[model samples]
Target: MSLLEVSDLRTYFYTEGGIVQAVDGVDFSVNAGETLGIVGESGAGKSVTVRSLLGLIDPPGTVVDGTITFDGQDLHSLTESELRREIRGSEISFVFQDPMSALNPVYTVGSQIAEVVEHHTDRTATEAWDRAVELLDDVGIPDAAVRADQYPHEFSGGMRQRVLIAMALSCNPKLIIADEPTTALDVTIQAQILDLFEEIQDRYNTGLIYVTHDLGVVREVCDRVAVMYLGEVVERGRYEDLFNDPKHPYTQMLMRSVVTPDRPVSSLDPIEGAMPSAVDPPSGCRFRTRCPVAIDDCSTIEPPDYAVTSDHAAACLLYDDDFAGDPPVLHERTTGGGRDE
Candidate 1:
């Protein structure tokens, strides 16, 4: 069974300007021990989607529709307080983008981690502190016992991230939601963090949802991927498949824009234009205005998820038989990892 399943999830913010449809009709699931990457440009609603799963959206924003099911239980039915007391740390945990901000400077690293442990489990104060040190050790922190007593500022960026990871694992959550966890670190540190994530997942068999816009990170870590555009998933498939044979034009453009070993920087095709405002996104297919191959009907009709394979699909009309005059030739992912016409 899937560890977490989100269907038709919609989260909107009530503002004087208009309702910002941050996450509109999004659907994806993560199975136990599997890693799913949600990739998109800024404003694609990746963070909001994950936040909604944990009932973390506060005032001015709310989950308007759909269900969030984790471990076969409907999370939407729980009250915010109930979610915090029961689910947030025990069954699911979050590793936010900025570790420095997430940590409280006034508290020692061990105290912060121990606080979470004490809240979720029946461990005593002394035991919780012990567990915090052990967790820090588990996440590769050197001299974890000594580091645990140090304040957040004492640790470097990468070390602080490790502390956050340790805290996330404190309660042995079934799933972990990491939002751009390594975005701020140097490339070497980023690589190490990615390796650490894979290592931790393997050790615990924990389901993972990694939210990132980095194609390189997606390629390295994700088993399956969902490509978001203007608040909707435009394409999804196995990482290698999506990376090479991107079915949706948006996905294709994203692939073309990234730097690869074979594709030189000059030859790379950067996607044009910024993402449209979510409050007033384009009609019908949200990506139509930016899609290079958009047809006339694309403006009038929103395409459904067209199956390219049993496990791969794209929400683009170009893949549908009636929409395209001729049966469109599906792009093949060449063995060399280049976009072959």
Candidate 2:
């Protein structure tokens, strides 16, 4: 069985205006020692989906339906206290995007990590401190022992990220959810952090859920890719399959926008139209409003995930065999001209 399986998960916020369906009917899985990247635009519900998995959604927001099974244990069945005591930190951990806000300015880095270790494991305070230093060293932090005593401000952006990673590793959790962990760092530093994540995953044999809008970052780290739109997973498959042969129009647009080394800056074609608001998302397929290949049925009937291959699936009317018309071709705009696919 997979290490984590999320089925038709739905998380909605009861706002004064209306219900904002942040995560509506999402499904995915992560295997042991595998990295699954959830990629999408800002309002695609990538972060909210991961937060829902950990039962971290606050007041007004509720996980109204679906099952999140981790190692055969349904996470939704556990109470807040039960999740905190048994599941969170010990069984699964989270690494947030911004290290500056994640780490407390008042506390030394080592103490922060040690606190989690002490709370989640049988290690004594002293033993936890030692483990914290070891974790810092493992994540490639220099002068680990001395740096451990320093405050969050004392470390650089990359170092602070490493510290957060160390804290995530404190309890030796089976799964780690890193939500855009490299977003705030420089390109060079981002590469280092991504490398560290891969190393940690390999060394610990832990399942990893990497949430990021950067498809480039996903290409470097993730084994499988799930592309979310508005609040649903529109497509999912092996990274190579999804990257090389995107079956969904949104995914194709995302690929066309990627700044590859060979592709000039002028070749980038941004997708038109903003994402529909979650409060009242577009009916039928949420992406139909912006989909280049959207058909008449796409505006009225939601397309179920259709199999593009045994392992690849996409939710689009274009993939339906019963559709008689020719599929709309996407044109990649270039500097001099447009290339039709």
Candidate 3:
């Protein structure tokens, strides 16, 4: 069985304006030693979906439906106290986006990591401290023993991120949810952090759910990719297949926007129109308003995930054999003229 399986998950925010459907019927799974990249534009519900798995949704938001099974146990069945005691940190850890915000400025870096170890395991304080230093060293931090005693401000952005990673690995979790772990770091530091994640996953055989909008990072680290739009998974498949020949119009537009080495600067075509509001998204297919090949049925009948291959699926009406007119071609708009044929 998969290490983590999320089925028909729906998280909604009870806002003053209206109920914001942040995560609307999403489904995916992660296996041990595998890295699944959840890529989408902001407000696409990538972070919200992962948060729901751990029962981290706040007051305004609620996980209204669906099941989150982690390591064969249904997460929803566990009480808040039980989840905190047995599941969180001990089984499934999280490496948040910003270390500066996530880390306690008052406490030493080692103390924070040690706290988790002590809380989750029967380790003595001294043993937890020792383990903290060992974890820092494992994550490629220099002068681990000395640095562990230092505060968050003492370390650089990259070092701080490493510290957070070390803390996440403190209890030897089976699954690690890294929510944009490389955010705000320089390109060089980002590369280093990505490399560190690779090393950790390889060494520990931990399942990873990498949540990021950066397609470049996904290309470098992810084995499988899930593309989300308007809180729904528009396309999902092996990275190679999704990148090379995107089945969904949304995925195709996203790939066209990325600055790849092979694709020229002039070839970068941004998807026109903004994402529809999640509070009251477009009818039928959520992406129909922005889809280049959207047909009448796309606005009336919701298209289920169409199997393009054994493992590849796309939620687009065009994939249906009965789709009217010519098949939609992914084209790049040129500077001088119209879209390339």
Candidate 4:
């Protein structure tokens, strides 16, 4: 069984204008020691899904429907204090995008990491301090003994991220939710951080939810991937399967935009059109407005998820049986005229 399961979770914000669906009817599960990558354009609700899982969404934003169960316990049903005591940073830890902001300006890195260990575990202060240094070393921070005494402002962006990772690992949590953990780092630092994550997961046998807009990072670190669009999971499968045979138009367009060394720069095809606002997303398929192959029905009725293989599923009309005639051949349609009526 999976360690965490999110089913049809809807997180929305009630603004004066209308309800903004941040995370709409999303579903996925992460097995023990598995790394699940969530990839999409900005405003796709990747971060919202993770935030909602931890009950971190503010008052204006509410988890409207569905269940977020961690290890068979319903997270949405847990009491506020109970959740804080038992779940957050105890069973699950989050390493946010901005490490500089995540750490306190005045507290020593060792004090922060030590506090996490002391809070979650039955360890003495001296023992926790020793463990904190070990975690610093584990995350590849140099001079761990002395550096642990330094403040957040004393470290570089990459080092601060590493410190946050160390703090996250202090609890020995079952799951780690890393939200663009290497966002501000250079390529070399990005590689090193990713390597550290892999090593830690291997060492601890913990599940991971890696949320990012970077396709290259997803391909590199994730065992499986779920592509999100406008709060829904548009496509999901093994990393290799989705990358090799992407069925969703949105996923295909994203792949086209990626500029790899092997692919000529001229071959890169950027997907046009901007991501629609969550407050009033386009009807039917949320991606319809931006999809090059969007058909008339795509704007009227939502498509059912079609299984491409046992492990792969995509939410698109091209695979729907109810749609009349042969599935619209995308290769023949550029202006949406080749669709079967």
When summed lDDT is taken over every stretch of 10 residues in candidate 3, the lowest stretch is 332-341
Q: What C-alpha lDDT, on a 0 to 100 scale, does residue 95 get in candidate 4?
A: 95
lDDT of 1 at 170: 100
Please give each candidate's TM-score: 0.95, 0.95, 0.95, 0.94
Per-candidate count of clashing residue pairs (backbone under 3 Å)? 0, 0, 0, 0
Q: Is candidate 1 or candidate 2 better by lDDT?
A: 2
TM-score of 4: 0.94
- Ranked by TM-score, the better of candidates 3 and 4 is 3
Error of 1 at 316 (Å): 0.5
lDDT of 1: 0.89
lDDT of 1 by residue, 1-341 (tens): 68888889999999998999999998888899999999999889999999999999987999999898899899999998899888998889999989998999999999999999998889999999999999999999999999999999999999999999999999999999999999999999999998999999999999999999998888888999999998899888888788767788888878877777776689767788888898998988999888767789889898889998977999988877876464333333334753232
Quality of model 4 by C-alpha lDDT:
0.87
Estimate, for each residue in 75-173, the C-alpha lDDT of model 4 and write its tens digit. 999887988999999899999999978898999999999998998889999999999999999999999999999999999988999999998888889
Steric clash pairs (candidate 4): none
Residue range 1-341, candidate 2, lDDT tens digits: 99999999999999999999999999999999999999999999999999999999997999999999999999999999999999988899999989998999999999999999889878999999999999999999999999999999999999999999999998889999999999999999999999999999989999999999998898889999999999999999998778777878888888778776667689778888899899999998999888767778888989899988877999988878898876545634345222112
Model 4 poorest ten-residue lDDT run: 332-341
